[model samples]
Target chain A: MQMDERKRKILRAIVQDYIATAEPVGSRTIARKFDLGVSPATIRNEMADLEELGFIEQPYTSAGRIPSDAGYRYFVDCLMGAQTLSDEDKEIIERESTKKICEIQEVVSQTSRLLSELTSLTSLVLGPQKGKSAFGKMHFLPYQPGQVIMVIVKENGVVENHIVDVGDNLTAEDLQKVADVFNQKMKGYSLSQVKRSMLHEIYSELSRQRHLIDNALEMLDAILDGSEEDEPIYLGGTLNMLNQPEFRDLDKVKSLFKVFEENEPLKKLLLPRQEGLNVTIGGENTLKEFRDCSVISATYKVNGKTIGAVGVLGPTRMDYGKVIAIVDFMTKSLTEVLARGKPRGYK
Target chain B: MQMDERKRKILRAIVQDYIATAEPVGSRTIARKFDLGVSPATIRNEMADLEELGFIEQPYTSAGRIPSDAGYRYFVDCLMGAQTLSDEDKEIIERESTKKICEIQEVVSQTSRLLSELTSLTSLVLGPQKGKSAFGKMHFLPYQPGQVIMVIVKENGVVENHIVDVGDNLTAEDLQKVADVFNQKMKGYSLSQVKRSMLHEIYSELSRQRHLIDNALEMLDAILDGSEEDEPIYLGGTLNMLNQPEFRDLDKVKSLFKVFEENEPLKKLLLPRQEGLNVTIGGENTLKEFRDCSVISATYKVNGKTIGAVGVLGPTRMDYGKVIAIVDFMTKSLTEVLARGKPRGYK
Candidate 1:
């Protein structure tokens, strides 16, 4: 059931037209608009063959034809051309991506939002890989009677905070000494490097401080080693999903809503272990619920190292030509800004 | 268009049965299952009348009846009985809710996951309301040369960190003195309470200790007063939406996914600032895309004060009977655990 060149052209034309108008496409419409130098009869014959091959379907006896799931699959893989972004679109993405690079979280969050706004589709951006960050410094400050605040700063400038118990009584000088020791020894080391041996070394050194902050030191070790829960997942422009007609069915709406509710599947779907712009079409996503949808994703980098993934989700009928171009340009723009590694100076 | 008591009972029976089975309800089947003490013919006549009034529909001439949108509306508003949770369900919720209350973010995230698992439906939870938590303390710790980490602890035991710049050269002693003054003056006061007059009072006093750190106080004030953004919205079980029959249509699926992407709309949807459980059925929600859906939500509290909202989303065919009971009970359980403040001293 292989399609000939003319049949491929007809299939692409139908899918393209259906995506634009969201209406069933007819042979007469394609014959008149596309100027393929074929008569209505010949075009109709090709459409009949296309339908026989499962690429198109007629809603009823009198209605026009629409692309079946198989039709969209072929269009995305073989027929669709790479859409070129307008100069204005490029400038918009460049401005937005470069606007905030100092804060990695901000860069990812803003990039998702900007991509969603530019494409008018749902966008997702994963945060920087925590495992990759080298420890730059850590500071412990006492707050109240029993609570202590711990801030971990990575070499890439990402800062995270955790609160741990410091028992009932501790002097300000004791906390300061603990902070100084941590900064001197742990700086420039990754979290993985701060293993049990490193903890034993720090514990023996703290014994010389008369047990003043021994509890705080143990708590610091726990905070650094145990805080390996998954990094935050950034989602943006969910409202954009509402604009697509695929969500009109009540059941389809609910199932898709469910996918957006739990983010673990999405995080796993966009895992940065993979390379290039990965497109998971219907039945390809790991999650059974997203079987009918498609995910278009790519990894973003900073200084030539992959940091996280940025992706967009829509129905299998997703306009791949446009979304792919936007995602491709956005990944490049994001890499350029993040590589600079400087906060946008305030006006 | 008005129905007698018997017709009402029959409509309720049909809707409830149809909702559970997702099958057309036949008169004979209803007669046998419900023991309505009426003949199948009598039930058939009433069902015919009901269909004329748009309470039910027949997919084909020979098929049994299914509840129409009007029938579902009626069941939700007037006929549906209050749902009671089993002891096992209550215990599971209580056990999960009481695990760790100090981590407010973790509580919200886990609660959303638990609710989704319990209901087998999508769940959404908003973060703690900023205005609800009074600021208790602020501390500063220096990291590297230009970076200073600011720790703000709320009265509810939530800790937040922000990294700010304090020029290029400041020692540990200077930062400690600056922190001491800030804690002494601003302890037990909210961020809003730190006004210009109060900032000036702290600055003039700090000038007496270290002029180098005093010069950095203005930037610190700006960072403290202006850096807070809206809290993040917690959503879970979005992938579950794909499991429902309602979202099978791509347009509806896209619309619902779009809602999860935009923070502002989601914040507005979840934060109506209303009291008690808020149930917005189809067409009642402010967002047009949600007109075909229903949201069952309730506000959770701490120490008898309203803090945030947790909700579940589904199609108009959503099990209002079950979700309403679950949301109400979970909110109560969450509030009780949070009010206790600390974990049980089992250790």
Candidate 2:
């Protein structure tokens, strides 16, 4: 467990070489490619020691050794150099994030695509969480003879529409009057706050005056009663997995895709637990499907509150330093975009 | 090419056998599997004649013959029988379509997933088109001190929001006044109708008294000016393509995925040219990228007007009769769901 200086250098060399070539690293290749002053015999001895310490393993009897999960973790935590992104990648992030995207969903969707394009890895973006967004306003429009469409807007610019049957009796003017009352009372309250405390007060007042409007009020309560189900998980660049040498086996590709399609397990994988950048390398992830993969995720904030996360999924042999740098830059860019009132067109 | 009853049977047997097993069909295997009265020698002579007529081809010099694109076309048009859905497949369609979906996008998205799941191929669903939809209503909510979020709803239940800067001088009531007037005039008119004839009448009238509201009108014009960009082509089960033997080559998989990732070509391929079920087999597709694939697509309706399409994409060896039947059933289900107005909650 004690990683001496020579062992750390050997582990870093193996990991970097494996990531670049996708082939196991041998002592001769390391001595030729990298200028480590040590001879091939010394490097070979150091590799054996690292393998004995459980940092690397030989995939085949005659083949060179490759870094294990623990090795990747150590390189990321200790031996990796600071990542400096290429000018092209920096420009891509700037061009994509500043495009004329109007909706929060568009912002998140584009960010997801940008992450994958930049890193050549599958990206998943959890859109801004709805629980903390306060109620901005509400409007009811007469849709059909017996139906009215209720459009609710959140302070963070999330919009949802629910159809309610209010019968043929209520005209557009009448529904507008009811919507005005609800808007006045519930204006700056978060959805949870309105669902808990404001529902009783508003319902009692409306029921005492106009009993007929009680149906619409009850429908509003029922709409927000359950948690927001429409919060989407945007997935991009799944085909990129096919390009990875690690996922050349079809079974691995299928298992990874099943997690994406099922969504529940992927949501668990992406749920941000803390404030800053987090990396879970192979074997560190709780889900067995992801044991061969590495995830680099960071939560984005709105008004300094963590609202959602953006992350990348790739083979454990991924370029950890570069992917981490891209994900970190993306998280900061997304937070800035969402904090601005309008997603774009301010120029 | 004419007056060939025996040749028809031989070609039908070859197509069916090859579709079942992705391998080329040999005369011995055909004679053993099918109840053809002809000897293997006789079948081989008939296969040679069918190949001479451009129906089938041998992949390698030593391999048996496989159905060419022309053979598949002939089988679909002449030899294929009426498809009957299995009890399990019918139940899956019934269960999935009747789930508690609340949005048209959800309906199309679920249908795409069901198509791919049932057929073991990739599915694409184009959400309801916005051109033929009439304007249902519009609302303006104060987003920040100088901004407003414009939520526009179509009669077909599609909703869109655009944030516009209307200056801090206008109150919520003033914006409402402008919205009410516009909504009153534009209600029940198709988006094209409003864009063409009504723009002059409304914009001239609004600019006469309050030129401040003109910015909002211009935003609406710019929003609907270009064709709908958000009609959203939902693609599902791309990983299923990898399961096919034809896509085992990573280069082929990469090329196919590039077509799916880029929207314009796929959009062109899915555009419904006529009513009822449409099938384009290999070599029939105009795009070279899909030359090795077959597409079965059908347009869905709302209130008797064609609005959108659903389709499946698979290798050239796809089961034609069954996929056609399933796509037909889904088209009817989607049309019915959209015609009912509410996507779900009616039960």
Candidate 3:
């Protein structure tokens, strides 16, 4: 049998109704609520065909139907319609996102909160990659007689500082000269670019300052690639997920919570497939915790490179059209703010 | 009407059993589970007096009894005995807490995760007050032609850097001179001390560099008291709270979650009453969201000052002995780490 237009309309109505009421959608309810322009008997015949084709499922003996994972996938792929966000929502998202946020961590945390508030679902926001920050300025200050602190300021205004001990051979003036040499060579380059290409030149020029350079190079790598500054997922309004009726089962909530605590698994689930919005329906996700959830994510960017992602986790009965629209708008707004914050000292 | 040792033992047994099972305690179960050496008829009579004293209550018309807020308070105050953690639990907590974490925020986040994991309850770890960090070192680095970035390294390895614009008269030499003067006077003091006592002396000496000094002081104040670095309540294992049987009601769970999101309310709830463990039973909480829950918090200190707090939030039938022990142990471990991490620049 062909998957025709009429069957598509019926499936959309079922998914929409289940999302609204958290109840099974019956053929009669569809006939009454949605203007599919068909009788309940005809709708029932179409529902049977849809279920047979695996686009929908009858959960139990007497209950109405729910969209299966394949059903949601089909709808997302071929049938999802135009999504419009309200003027009020657009204003709120824009306002929260455009605040003068200097640090990427703050931006991620704020974005996560706004997404959760706007959509009433748990939101996860990871910061731009550590390598995304270009080297702006590095400062060398005498911490004590034996130790010096190196502070690296990124053009985007993130400051990461670490301590290193210097031998008696290096004076405070020598520290400044060493800093200037590194600064001149590595200026305007992000850590990723520097690590990939610039290390050979840096290592050769500072050969005479071998003792200090050894420690300095180590500090530089740490500043660039270290996990100390690795921005973990900023989870916001996480409890909002409990509002869903399907999570009433304690065991179900426990399994999902475990995945959240073990953030790496959920991070894998949200990692971008291509670029833009990626939706994984129930059973489409490999993690057992997410088997009951549908994840909708969008990778956010800075200067054309995809650096991080934002995601919303909810029951499969989520309002895909509305949530997708919110996510799409949020990522764009985030990108605009990031563009405005061009790294300082890049020249 | 005389309250004797037997009555205290019965109340303790009832509270302990209710906490363990999340079920109403009955006279027969008490006889079977705890060795009170009393008949069911005698236990029933004692239970009536306990209820009359507002320590235990019956829901609807059930014969089984659950402890009321008053009962919990009575147990915590008098009947509760000291509880010890197992050797395995002690080792796990010590290992996790004693990791070589230098940043206060990372320390707080790790501690929160450990507390939540050890107790199987939601944990809240507040960061130390901003004024708690003493000055370690300050570096002045040239940035764009008109601006210079000032990086302040705290003893705890936290680096805060901000860009400041310099005037035309302030040559590179003058910048170094101003830095040396400020560094000489402010080397051993905290930001609070610098702001409180040394501002006048420094302002008079660097009067020619007043334009930069004005902005630098303003920046210093902002760094010391800014909300950007405000120690937010680091909440961990929040989903674990859903595992409680009491959270089976979606509405209750939703209301409680609202408090978690609106962190100010929850912060108020956890703020220390004194310097040690604070046990606020269900009705004892001022916040309405916590009326059905209990909180156990202990203030963690650095040096001798009480800097921040750590707490656990759970339903009133919480395992008080275990949770209290965990909170107490976690706070002490945190204090030791803070002590070891004395700010770097302090003489």
**DockQ: which candidate is best?**
3
The per-prediction CA RMSD against the true structure, in angstroms, equals 6.9, 4.1, 4.5
- Give each prediction's DockQ, rounded to 2 decimals: 0.36, 0.43, 0.52
By DockQ, the candidates rank as: 3, 2, 1
- Model 2 chain A scores worst on lDDT over the 10 consecutive residues at A338-347
Local accuracy of candidate 3 as per-residue lDDT tens digits, A1-347? 87999999998888888889989899899999999899999999999999999999988976899999999888888888788898899999877866776556667778898999889998888777665556767778776677777877766566667777678677877888778887898887766566634566766766666777778767767666564354477787777777788888767766776677666886787787789999989988888778878988998777787878899988888989888999999999988877886533111
Q: lDDT tens string, model 3, B1-347?
A: 76789899999999999999999999899988999999888999999999998899998576699999999999988888886877787898888866775456678788888888888898988777665555555668876777887877655455677777788667888888778777788765666676644788887888899989887767766765454354478898788877888888767767877778666877787897777899999978988878989999999886687878999989999999889988988889888877886533211
Show where candidate 2 strays beyond 4 Å: A95-101, A134-136, A142-144, A155-157, A171-177, A180-230, A341-347, B1-3, B91-102, B134-138, B141-144, B153-159, B171-177, B180-215, B222-230, B340-347
In terms of docking quality, how is candidate 2 classified?
A: acceptable
Q: Write the per-residue lDDT of candidate 1 for residues B1-347, one digit (tens) a residue.
A: 68899999999889778767767899998999998999999999999999999888898997999877677777777888787887787899988865755566667788999888888777889866655445556677655577777676666565666666666666677777777777787776655666888878877887654554443444444434443455667877777777777667666666677677677777766765589987776666789877767788888776566777889987766777888889999988877766676431100
Q: What fraction of the true interface does each of the listed models get right, in terms of native contacts kept?
A: 0.75, 0.45, 0.75
Candidate 2: TM-score of chain A is 0.88
For residues A1-347, could you state the per-residue lDDT of candidate 1 as single tens digits? 77899999999999988888888888899998897999989989999999999888898996899888778878888898767887888889877765644556677778888888877777888866665556667677665567667676666566666665665655667677767777787787765687778767767777654354455445444445453456667777776666677666655555565566577888877774468788777776777767767778998776576767899887767788888888999998877776675542110
TM-score of chain B of each: 0.80, 0.88, 0.87
